[model samples]
Target: MAWAILFLAGLCEVAWAVGLKFSEGFTKLLPSVFTVGFMLLSFWLLGLALRNLPLGTAYGVWVGIGAIGTAIAGIYLFDEPATLLKSVSLLLIVAGIAGLKLSSH
Candidate 1:
């Protein structure tokens, strides 16, 4: 349940990040509004997850998901650099998150 909320929080993070890009320095009203909404939801979901999950582990996983998912989405959707080194680093982040989850159990 906590993990599920964390995952949703991560997904919201991704949405808000991409929304930021479309916000056009906050000039674009719709995207900026959506971005703010998503950001709020992200934080709310994170708080819910923290109710059950340890702070360090949950925060780490939440950040890991946001970082990696956003990077991948940026590269694939926005044609940001998809360099080999960056891919490997993302893989390492995922591994670390998996390690934390396994060890928590």
Candidate 2:
């Protein structure tokens, strides 16, 4: 359950990140509002998960998920480069996250 909440928090992290881009320097009202809303929600859930999870592992996993999700979203939404190197790097991040998860027990 904690992992599930953490994963959703990670998704919210992605939401706010993309929201930051769409918010257009906070000039756009709706996206800006959403960006701020999701940011708080993300932090709330992260804090909840941290109560039960190890600080280093939870924070690293949260960041790893956010980084990978945002990079993928950027590729599709912003036409960012989709080079082989980028793909390999993302896989490495996933591997690290998995390693952390497996070692957490």
Local distance difference test scores for all models: 0.93, 0.95
Any idea what lDDT model 2 has? 0.95
Question: Among these predicted structures, which one has the highest lDDT?
Answer: 2
What tens digits encode model 1's per-residue C-alpha lDDT throughout 35-70? 999999999999999999898899899999999989
Q: What TM-scores do the predictions have?
A: 0.96, 0.98
Error of 1 at 94 (Å): 0.2
For every candidate, C-alpha RMSD to the true structure in Å: 0.8, 0.6
lDDT of 2 by residue, 1-105 (tens): 878889989999999999999999999999999999999999999999998889899999999999999999999999999999999999999999999899889
Error of 1 at 31 (Å): 0.6
Backbone clashes in model 2: 0
Off by over 4 Å in 1: none
